[model samples]
Target: MTSPLNTLPALEKTLQEVEILLAEAEGFDEDRKKLVVLNKAAFLLLVGKFEAYIENLVEEFVFAINSLELRAAHVPERLLAEHSVQIVKNVKDHLNNGKLEKVNSMFIDLSRYWAEIEPCNSLNISNKFSYGKHGEKELIKMFKRCGIESIFDEIVLYDPQEKYDSNEDSVLDIKGIFNSITNMRNNILHQDETPTLTVGNVKYYKNILVQLAECLEELLQKIISNADSKRQKEGMFDYVI
Candidate 1:
């Protein structure tokens, strides 16, 4: 598809995939293998959605730049192809380097691609996020607080002493939760063996995934709202970890 025509439809497709997977995940029974399958599927869908957002941004930028009376070198097409060859290259490099979050890598590419045209659009200098090592003391605290302490045999946190007090009103443990999930996922990933998922483990993982989704949704809402508010702020036109 042409760059301009491809942008919105691709994003819509990704968003649709996210919605479908999230809904399907909601109805998943407490089956270990099924949950694992669903979890991986949902993760892939999310990453695809994020990549689509990055691609759409690149495509839209190209369209906008092409309309302006700028030099050919100034157009995104000169540097970024319609098929996103540069982006795919970076993602490949990141995957080869053992970088886990391809979505963040794609976001970095988006920011860099945008900065070349509009520096103001390069909001975040880096897009990397770390939940730290699993089985750390803080993760233990998180599982304990979340009422699922025994599911994990080990905890590996980056900072053991980091304080993580969940608000009585909130069910999310943003810092520790992701770390715990990543740890479990790594065990299954790195071992080259099938994961032994007990009934308890399945339940715990399902709960963690749900909480993670809610936390992310809430955070995204807050960021979007803040951007809207700032766009209307004193003499400002418009504008995350």
Candidate 2:
């Protein structure tokens, strides 16, 4: 199926680059993965680009839904709640620090956000998306706020190799892979010891990210299309009898 997502193609290109790096590291031979640092670079690039793809995909979804001019009542309740997540976090942080002045100001801003938001206007999407420490938990939480429940279940991933019996019984472990990759990248970046690096692993991880993004794109497209369907000439629901 062709994806409507703008970011998926670019993400595919990044994964291709990771494969290119891996091939070069192996001296264009599949016999063995050589050059440990280059292989590590491939892994890091995969992790960084994968993270960016998820973030940009969310931003894309928000902007697409905003353009539809759908009534807020028609928008998913969790999505509306998501719009205030950042402000609420700020309020908590300020109160924790004993910054009463900042806390009061945040409350004022919160009130304004509630008062000024029009039912048929654009959603006030929060800018402070906290997927920086990328993992399964971060991805699931972010998607849940956007009204996607049990996102991992919603995604269907396939193994690139004919090696696995079925995608449903994937050995790659789709749900667990994101956190594993992020943790491995952190160890490689922060710790002094060199982590195990191989061309096969690099390519395997790249395919995993690509498959995840592809499924995510399909999921978001469906959501945005549904939102667009709710809009009419008046751009708000009239509750017609």
Candidate 3:
């Protein structure tokens, strides 16, 4: 297991294993069922791992922010403001459930929660997402929940010199990569068809995920900066010791 702080390495480790398995499967070409296994099982596992990587990293990031014990006042203004919308959603959800509600008490409750709120966590980010598409838009939206706006847009501006794939100089089509991977994975899971996947196909998807993880690892540093910058470093000076 890789440290939660270093998501890229953890992601790479799993992908490397998957690649090795695919490579080994080639040696047993006499067994046709091995191809089916790779098509269904290994492919599904690959998608699951990528989704887990995204969710786990995001969850760990929120936990890291909260574990610092920073008060709401010490948090980034944009992040706090975004989370306040979640509070509103929480209040609205119970009221509009085809039942009449009291306006005055709800107002008081909202004010109270706002006044007593701590740093927002994963729950705040997960609200109202009925289906987990895990597509490019959804993933970018997840990062927005943490105040990192337009993440893929930032990825587009990646320096060619610091490429995720050193052997390739072409720009990364982040959206296309995600769209392809999710489309294939969703087709396999949501449908009954035994999708045609090859050792090369598995390797292809694995490599794409590896590249994406590199992008995420580099961009996610902004989260640490957000946490550190918003910390109330001089608060102890105001103590009455």
For all predicted structures, in order, the TM-scores are 0.33, 0.75, 0.69
RMSD for all candidates, in order, please.
14.7, 5.3, 5.5
Q: Which candidate tops TM-score?
A: 2
Q: Please identify model 2 stretches exceeding 4 Å from their true place.
A: 1-3, 28-34, 85-117, 127-132, 163-168, 232-241
> What lDDT does the true structure give each of the candidates?
0.42, 0.71, 0.63
Residue pairs with backbone atoms closer than 3 Å in model 2 (clashes): none
What is the full ranking by TM-score, best candidate first? 2, 3, 1
Better-scoring candidate (TM-score), 1 or 2: 2
Model 2, span 41-159: residue lDDT tens: 88998888887787788888777776664566556667867776666777888899899999887666545434534443455564334734557877887788678987988876777
Best by lDDT: 2
Model 2: how far residue 195 lies from native, Å: 2.7
Clash pairs for candidate 3:
none
Q: Give one digit per residue, the lDDT tens place, for model 1 in 61-148.
A: 4343333323223332323343244456567778788886885867665665544432233221111122443333543343222122
Candidate 1: give the clashing pairs: 133-156, 134-155, 134-156, 135-155, 135-156, 136-155, 136-156, 136-157
